[model samples]
Target: MTTTPERTEPSTTAGERAMLEGWLEFHRETLERKCAGLTDEQLRTASVPPSDLSLLGLVRHMAEVERGWFRRTLAGEEAPPLYYDDADRDGDFHPAEEDTWEEARATWQAEITRARELAADRSLDDLAARTSRAGESYNLRWILTHMIEEYARHNGHADLLRECVDGSTGD
Candidate 1:
């Protein structure tokens, strides 16, 4: 029998930033755990036909999402995607392939690190410089919550994908 991957968040005594960050990190690790022990091929395995979604796709998408919100929007830097194309909006979820696990994971982790650094000193209320696609605005708090929502949604998908790939399942 295989052991379940451990995923833990800090205690409740943590501050607001720490709490938000903790939940975000928890979801991140939850997604990672779903992909744990899978091969490159397994990671690339898509769901039913007509859907290109996969574990690898989620990792890639979140990496770009993190970069877009934290680095570009929050930090006021020009940032392009690491695995997507403007001409192909869903490029993050498409063309999921093999032997790309290491690169994908590394990119995601790096984006996460940059996000933390960019958010460290800023208050949650600090507004993002980049306007939303709908021409709206957001703050660091919104970004953090958005990220949590994004991860939670994708982690649900990851749970399904992982279970389909192997019988493993957990919270």
Candidate 2:
């Protein structure tokens, strides 16, 4: 059984960067904890009928999101989608039969590491190297906040999925 990473409680009064990063990390670990101890088949089980939102799919989706926001938009790299593309926009949410829990977890963790490295030296007000689809530039602060919000929203779905999988639930 794979063990879940420990989730630290974000400080109540940290600075802006610390608070944002802390909350983001907290949510990241929360997702991991929600998926912990499940078999690959279990992780891939679309327990929620009509939704097909498996835990492994969420992990894969987050990896693509991390790569898109940090590696592509923020750093201006030509990092293309890992699990999705023009023809399959929702590919990440539908894990292929070959997808494994271990691989998905590793990819998600790698993206998180790269995201931290990319954001380390930038100021909150630092503009991204690229602009949004609407041509508006996003600062580091916005990216961090958006990432946190993204994780928070998915974590809610994760909570329900985990319960459906094994009757396990908590923060």
Candidate 3:
């Protein structure tokens, strides 16, 4: 798979914004690169152990994750969770056979676009003004850091999943 181009934050006077931009860029590129090349069947295929984790599922889950962190939590939307059913938290990673590739891809693309548009205009110093999953309040700084950590954790999962799928490695 080819690595997506790195988007080093522009050298602007807005230092905080630059940092947040860089973090978002890194994670976004990481995810896009992880999904590079693979048929619809491949995207939905699980690893040898029969786990439910699939590339398509990961994309769907990450889209939901991005929405949760950057949009809902940061924007203080008080909106309900996306694709998150309390009864089955693991549902994000378990793709039904009926799930079409177009649906999954479109959902991910929409979330990514929304995140970029929202974040592009704001500085990290600009308060996101939202509460955490635990109901704790947080600023944009905390949210960006938490998102970076979340993406890193999932990239590790992507690495393993990619290796299992095609023996590919590295960004």
Candidate 4:
């Protein structure tokens, strides 16, 4: 059986950057823990009928989010959407029959790695390379906090999804 990933507790007395990164990492591991020990089919199962949210779908969506915020916005790369476009805005939340858990996990992890690399040398106050659709630029601090918030919110969804998947639940 697959095992849950271990999460590190965020330090209370750490500096701003460390605290933010710590919480983000903790939430990331929380998602992985929620999806752990599930087969490809289990990962793809949409336990909630009205909501087509699955563990695999969440992973894919987060991958897209990471790439969008870090690669495209922060680094100003030309990366396009991996699963969605104008016609399919919710594509990431709807994994195809052929989509596997392994592939989704790999893609998500790679995006996280790339995001860290992109933000490594930049200061928290460093402005992003690109502006939002409303023409507002964000700094690294805002991006990091936003990412943490994003993961925290999604992790809550993941908690319910995991319990529905196999009767597994935890913080």
Which regions of candidate 1 fall more than 4 Å away from where they truly are? 1-6, 96-99
Can you list the residue pairs that collide in candidate 1?
Answer: none
State model 3's lDDT. 0.73
Candidate 4: clashing pairs of residues: none
Return the number of clashes found in candidate 2: 0
Lowest summed lDDT window (length 10), candidate 3: 2-11
Summarize candidate 1's per-residue lDDT along 66-123 as a digit string, tens digits. Answer: 9998999988898877777778888888645543878889999999999999999999
| lDDT per residue (tens digit) for residues 1-171 in model 2 | 566679899999999899999999999999999988998888899998999899999999999989999999899989878888788899998887889988999999999999999999999999999998899999999999999999999999999999999999778
Evaluate all candidate structures by whole-model CA lDDT and list the values in order.
Answer: 0.86, 0.92, 0.73, 0.92
The lDDT-based order of candidates, best leading, equals: 2, 4, 1, 3
RMSD of 4: 0.9
Q: Name the lDDT of candidate 1.
A: 0.86
TM-score of 3: 0.79
Q: After superposition, how far is residue 105 of candidate 3 from its true place, in Å?
A: 2.5
* lDDT score for candidate 2 against the true structure: 0.92
TM-score per prediction, in order, is: 0.90, 0.97, 0.79, 0.97
User: What ranges in model 3 sit over 4 Å off?
Assistant: 1-14, 48-50, 126-129, 133-135
Window of ten residues with lowest summed lDDT in model 1: 92-101
lDDT, candidate 4, equals 0.92
